[model samples]
Structures are given as C-alpha cells and as structure tokens.
Target: MLTSESRRRDFPTLDGRAYLNTAAEGVPPLAVGEALAQYFRDKQLGMDGRVPHAAQWEAARALTAEFLGLTAAEIGICSCSSEAYNLAALALQLQPGDEVICTDLDFPASSTPWLQPACPATLRLWKHRSGALHVEDLIPLLSPRTRLVNVSLVSFYNGFTVALPPIVEAVRKHSPALLGVDVTQAIGRIPLDLRGADLIVSSTHKWILASHGGGLVGVPKDRAKEWTAPAGGWFNLEDAFGPGSFEAVKSKPGAASFMVGMPNYPALYAVRAGLEYLRGVGVANIDAHARPLVLHCLTELRKLPVEVLTPDEPDHIAGILAFKHPKAAEINARLHAGNVHVMNPTGRLRVAVHGYNTHDDIERLLRELKAALAAV
Candidate 1:
C-alpha cells in the first residue's frame, strides 16, 4: 500500500511545511525536476535533440493514455485545461437553438467557450443547491436541443465528487448531448472510470504533481468520428508539406487531431515522470490512503464553527476539504505564516491531501487552523 513515509522523500518541498494546497498547485516530485533537467541536457545533444524529444513526447502521450485508461491515439497534449475545453467546444460545432448545460459551480474555463458570440448555442447552468450539485437537478436541464453537457468530475470549489455514472445514464436517456468532463480536479487524485465520458480534459500541474504548460484531452474511439478538428498543423496532419506546397489537408484520427502545433516538451517530460510515479504507487492505494484522512478532517471540522462545504460522505468527497469563512483570506495568510499551506479563494478555504500527505500533515493543519480561526 502507498504510504506517506514511503513517498515523502520524493517531495522535498514538504521538508519545512505542511502543504495542503495540491488543489491550487501541486508540488512536483524530485524525479520531475530531474526529468526537466534531463530534457535540457538531451536537447543539447545529437541532431539538435529532435529525434530524442519526439520520442519523449510520444512516450509522454502513451503514459498519459495509460493514466487516463484511454489509447494513445485518443489522447492529445495542449497548453492547458482552457485550451482543451476550447478544442472541445469548437469540435461540438453547436448551431442556433442548441443548448449546452454547465454547472453553476464550474470554473469559467469549462463553460465560457460555449458562451462566445461565434458559438450559436445557449448556455444553461445546472445550479447547485446548498453547495452541492445533484444529478436530478441536471436531468431536467437535458433535452433534445442540448448538444453538449460540460461538468467537472470533481468540483474544484468544494471537493464534491459528482456521481458520474448516474449523470452518464441520465444524459443517455434524456438528451442527444455528448458528455464532456473536466477531470482537472479529479485526475491523479482518484480512480476514474472514464468510459462514460465522450471527451475528457485536464491540466498536468494539479494532483498529477507535474509542471504547467501542458494539458491532456481524450476522445474515446467510439466518439472520435462525431467531431472535426477545429485547427490543424503539420503535427496533426496526415500529410506534411512546406508553405509553398500547402493545400487542403486531413487530420490524423482521434485526439491527435487536436495537436495543432509543437508541444511543450519540457512540461510534457515532467508530466511523463509524474504519471510514471503515480502508476508506480497505484492510484487505488492512494485513494485508500486518503479516505481515512478525509474522514478524520470532516469529523474534526464538524466540531468547529465554520460551515463545511464539502460533503461528509466519502462517496461525495475526494482529496480536497473545503469550508466557508468570511475571514478565509486572513486565515490563509496566518496558516502561511505558520508554514502550513492551503487555498483561500474569496470566502472559502480548501485543503487538499495526496499520496505524499501524512496524518501528521492534517494534524498540523488542524492545529494551525484552530489558532488562525481564534485569532481572526
């Protein structure tokens, strides 16, 4: 089983602090740094490093495919989650009278693309009730006019893990809409059965413990034929040609069609290292390790005055635990002063735990949080 003691050495950033902010930005492992260094070293080598870098990119894509339980052909690497979402939005090619449903709790990147003037679709929000989104609420919003339904597999704001299987079943029954899921918050932190989603996207830097500048997009084989590539370049084309010889071109099959330009090689290399590390530890084991900690945090927080936004049920929660407090920003600064890291966005505080986090880390956060709350 994966344990904090076994994984702590890989994350040197935890040496003098309790890092409970994987939700905001993950701290990369030592191996990821070494991977980036090696990328530069390899770049300085034979043939201007083109062959080696291309191979590394392909390897990274393959590793990402394994991580997401999708085939390599179904995966495309891009700059970030927003770009992935944009690609998905463009591919849908919504027409007038088409409606797309997004949750009110969604990060703007997931829904804003559908609201652009160029997109002819009407954007509808599946509103959350009392800090929670229910599948039943989403069901009524779905209809024949719905062309796409975008949702985050896990709520970035509150750590609520939306029950996707029910969402999938509901969408299949109520609408012809394709399901697009933002796995940015859930990826690398939980076990994902991605078969239900037609398209999925994530950034590499969060719970994956990688660097920024790279993102993942996947389209399962069964759904790949339904969309067209919005843009194309030599990397995505079936036939390569120089500027003078340019003509109409066709994209390669599946998600590879989304790779419109050169990839972020350095970030992709680090992503490969991060994905490799997670597979080595096993994601299921990581989930098990986190469950008790989440329960403990939830149980303890109930004794405090703050409103727990994350559900107490393990089925509805993941690595993050969020709470509402008017003094959240102040408390976040206090925790930072005490060398305990967490995220405070406006009125809520979010603390995230991962494979490298220990019970001691949670206790440290609790102690510091109590002090900070009292001081506030």
Candidate 2:
C-alpha cells in the first residue's frame, strides 16, 4: 500500500529548512547517516586490513540494478555521471566522420564527452524548441553514420522532462546509433522503465539521497561483451589480486568492465542504504506524493509575472519546477533569508520537491516567494 507522507520526520535536514534544493544535492535520511558512521568506524578499526567489504560493494551494485529493473550484469558503479558517460563514450570508439546527436538545452556533462578532442566524431547540436525537447526534431538530424544520440532524461536547467522512448525507438529503427541517457536529474524522482536507452548514466547524489562519488551506468546484454573501458584497473580484472603474477589483468565481463579502479566501498554503503529506503516506500508512491506538490507550485507560479520553463501538462512534470524571474537574484536571496531553500541556476529559480517533501513546505515556499516578489 502506497501512502502519502506529508511530513518531514524522515529527513532531519527539513527540521528547520524547506530543503527544496534537491536538484543541487539531496539530504540523506537517518538510516544513510548511521550507515556512513559505521563505515567510518570500520575504517578506523582497520577491520580485515581492507578489501573485506567486497561483498557489500556487490550488494550495492545489485541494488542499483534492481532499482532499474535490470540484471546484475548490466550495472557498473562509477564515481559520478560524468565518469559513466565517459566510459560509454570510450566503449563506442567514435571514429572520424561519424556523427553524434545531442541537445543544446541539456547539461554540458552529457555532451562534453562526445565533444572532447579524444573522439574524432562530428557533434551535431539540436536546439530545444521553447526550452522543451521535441522528439520529432531529431528525425532530420540522424543519419546512417550517426554513432550515438545523447540526451538528458530531464533538463537540469528548466526541469522539463524529455519523452525518451519515442526518440529511442526512432533512432534504433533507422540507424545503429546507441542511445545514451543522462538520468542524474530523473532517476530517483521519476518512474523510468529503461526501455529506450542503450547506455544509461546517473549520479545517485540528488534524488537517491546519497553522498558524492557514487553513480551508476547501465549497458544492454548485447553490448556488454562488445564494450571495453579505455582505462584498466585491478577491480576490472577477472583474476584475483592476491598471490598472483600481476602480468595478466583481464577486464571483467558486463558493465563491471568500466570500473577503472577499486570501487568506493564507503560511498557504496551509503548508496545501498539510501536505495533501500526508496524501495521500502516504493517509487510509484513517491512520485504520487511529490508530483502534486510540484503541480501546486507550478499553478501558483503561473499566477505571477515569472515565465514558466517547465511544460504545463501533468505528464511533462516530475519533481522540478523552474521559473524565469527578472528579480531572480533578489527573490532567491529573500527566500534564503526566510529559510526556504531553492536553486537560482541559469537566471531561473529551480524548485525541486522530492518524495519526502511535505505540503507545508510548498505552502511556506509560495508564501515566501510572494513576499519576496513584492519586496523586489
């Protein structure tokens, strides 16, 4: 049974703050905090002299795979979304004259790797129509030489959700181009079936309620054996490290091949703890609870002088709502003064309401926003 939790008891950070800056970073619940403390204690005690926490690391990978409705073989644990994207970029081995399609509205983290000088591929940028990603526009851009089509599942700048399945099907039907997705903003906040993307990369910091240096990458079964990470490390080796001639270090099969080095066990523990909590509550329940608050915020913001960046339709909304206000800086400062936290990125105030956020938080934010607008 999925119940709505319109309270702040689960998240301690919301004790005195509205904590609407989830797109910036998430506040872990009490369980993740305790897990981190235990990790530190184990490290200080020098238990097993290191490498003893390998099983826990495997569990984290399994949890991530389960969250995405994938097999354990598909998940690769990386430090951040950028690292995962880079791994995907290397696996494709983009040759000269090959083309890669991406959007101008997406975060640079998704596009920059393709643009990097290391790959000689031609980068094609498609402008988002009115800050909204239109799947139809890509029909003209894709060609037989298109090696990859990269896109963000959600716009970090404007909170606009991209309908990915249509685009993914379109590209796959025409060309052999791989669909790479940056889900840093979408994964934990939205319901993702993972049907379209061949390579999915996401950082768990924002919506997963985990700390930094923890991210995940997904590769399909067909691409698993074909993909090999550019960089090699011991963890990727199929052979064990102890009492062995280190001359032959073979990369592990599946997405684990991208792990350039030892996995971050400490951070992986925190990731597991947070992921466990989300599962307990159920993602559909979380979306059902948080989305209403976003709609409420969008409804009120529409009544103001600000220009709404997110789409007006219900299906288009996730956990974020961004609005362009001329007094964005002033309004942000005043909102901060009033203990309401939000992000002012790209001249628009980006408000992210998570599953744990309460209705009171939305009400307080609106009241403060109105006052700040008047004062400005």
Candidate 3:
C-alpha cells in the first residue's frame, strides 16, 4: 500500500479540513498549481507558435491515453465532458425516427443534448433498480429503432456503479446500436478498461484532480470515419497553414478530429501534473486506501436513522457515498458549519472520499452526523 503521509502532502487542502467532495470537484495538488504558474511564466517570455502549444497539448493527450489504454489519436480535448457529449450528439448520424436510450439516473449533461428538440432523434429512458441500470430492465426498452445507448458508468446521486460489459454485449446483439459512456464519475476513482464501448467521455476535474477546462473523448479506431466532425476549425485539418490548405487537407481520423481552436495550454499542463501525481501513487494503491474509507462511512451511516443509498459490496462501490436523512438539508448545513465539506444533491448528502481521507476523518464525520441528527 502507498503511504498516506506522502499522499496527503500532494493535497494541501486536506491539512486544514475534511474534504469529502471529490465527486463534485477534486482538489488539485500543489504541483498542478505550480505547473500552471510556470505555464504563464513561459507565455510571458514570448512563446507563441503552434509547435510549442501542440507539443504540450499532445503530451497531455498521450498521458491521458496511457491512463485510459488508448492511442493518442483516439483522444480529443474538449472544454468539459458536456461539450464532449454535444460533439458526440452532433457528429452521430442519427436519422429521423431513430431512438437513443439513456438512463433516468444520468447527469443532465449526458441526457439533455440528445433530448434537444431540433435533434432528429427520440430519447428513451431506462429504469433504475436500486441505483443500478439492470440489463433486463433496459432490454425491454430497446427496439429495432434504437440506434445508440448512453449511460453513466456510475450514478452521481447514490454512487451505484453500473455493470457495463453485459449491457454493451446486449446492445451489440439486439441492434446495430452505438455504445457511449459518460465516465465522469468513474474515471480515476475506479478501475476502468473502456474497451466495451465505442465512444467514452470524461472530464478531468472529478477523479483526475485537474482544473475545470480539461476533458477527453475516446473513439475506437474502426468506427473513426463514421462520425463527422461536429464543429470544424483550423486544428481539425492537416497542414493548417500552407497555401491551398483548405483544399488539400483532410480531417484527422479518430476522435482527435473533433478538436477545434486552441486549448487551454496551462490547464493541459496542470492536468498532466495531476495525472503524474496519481501515477506516483499507483491507482490500485489509491483504491485500497479509498475503498476502506467508503465502507467505513457506509457502516457508520447505517447505524444512524438515515438510509444508506450506496451499494454494500466492495465490488459495486466507488469513492462516493450518498444517503438520505429526514433532515438532510439541516444535516448538510450543520456539517458545513463544522467545516466538513460534502455534496448535497437534492436531498441526498453525497460524501466523496479520496486517498487523502483517513479513518479519523470518518470518525469525525460520524460524530458530527450523530450530533446533528440528535439536535434535529
């Protein structure tokens, strides 16, 4: 197991407070802040060419690809995962009368773009059984008209992790549907091999511990040519500068073709630094440290009057734990008063535990929760 002492040093925020909000937004390390500062310093020195910018951008892409087990060409940088979904929705060749299936449990960012009125597609909602999108429940909704299936790898509210391999197989067997996944909740917190889906999208702000502007889209090599470039710009074409470039250049293959305009270079540098920090403390090691804390939180919540919404088994668990109390709103307010940060989505108090959290943190939260509950 990786040493918690060293891991805690990466995030200075943990020193002052008990931060249990990684699901909403991860706390970036000091190294990332230092790297962003260096980027601005370089920009002040008169570096203004595509080569230097593209090299930094490409290096970020390469590091992301290495983590996701994909080629650099398969990755595209986007402002956020929401934009990634919009790109997918626009680029997909969805004809009129086609059906696109997604879960009711998905974050609005994943569902709203496809459900837009102007889009020539019908949106189908899947039922959630105990926070899980079961294949049996979804299979009844799939029809010959179904063309795509989009689902979140983990539910944001209940922290229920989806079993995607069988769902992907069913989609392939039932119809000629494309599979897309919103892995924003599952990327760095959980072990993910994205080979089951055709298109995958995630934002680095959540689990990867990066800034807000960093996101990624991964596309399979075989279906690279099917989706058109959603919004074209100079970056989408080869030989962007030469004379007759517009006439001579072709769209780069795979998801990289979706990239347009200049990306936030400093943000990319910070994202790379964050990934490097995760790499130093191996992902499995991080998981070992995190899973126990989640279990501890769940165990403590079960002893209270509040209902535990997250799964009980370790296999179905992630870094997030959410529960509902009769006085959830009050509990959230009291926790905030105690300087314990967590997520309050609707009525559910979402507690996102990360590597920096310790057993004492869980004990403190439980003590505060009991006090808050007693007062209510």
How many backbone clashes does every candidate have? 0, 0, 0
Q: Looking at candidate 2, what is the lDDT of residue 88?
A: 71
Model 1: residue 231 alpha-carbon error in angstroms: 0.8
Model 2 lowest lDDT segment of ten:
1-10
Best by lDDT: 1
Q: Write the per-residue lDDT of candidate 1 for residues 1-376, one digit (tens) a residue.
A: 2555555578766877888899889988888999999999988986778887888788888988887889887889988988878777767777899999999878889999987889898999999887788889999999999998989988888888898889999999999999989898888889998778988889889999889998798889888866446565678777768564376777676587778788889988898998888888888888889878888988998889899988767788888889988888898899999999989887899989887788988899899999998999
Estimate TM-scores for all models. Answer: 0.96, 0.93, 0.94
Q: How close is candidate 3 to the true structure, as a TM-score?
A: 0.94
Question: Rank order by TM-score, top first?
Answer: 1, 3, 2
Candidate 3: which stretches are off by over 4 Å? 1-4, 48-52, 239-250
In what order do the candidates fall by lDDT, top score first? 1, 2, 3
TM-score of model 2 vs. true structure:
0.93
Best by TM-score: 1
Give the distance in Å from residue 3's predicted Cα in candidate 2 to where it truly belongs.
Answer: 8.4
Whole-model lDDT per candidate: 0.85, 0.81, 0.80
Q: Cα RMSDs of all predictions?
A: 1.7, 2.4, 2.1
Per-residue error (Å), model 1, residue 238: 2.1
Tens digits of per-residue lDDT, candidate 3, 1-376, equal 1355664666656775677898998988788898788777767767564455567788888878887778887888878888777877777868898999989878888889877888899999997776666788888878889978998888887787877788988898888888888888887777777777888888888888888887788887887875546466777666578888766666676687667767878778877888888877667778888888888789878888988887676677788888887789999899888878888878889999877777877887888888899999
Q: lDDT per residue, candidate 2, 279-317, as tens digits?
A: 888888889888888998999989987898887877767
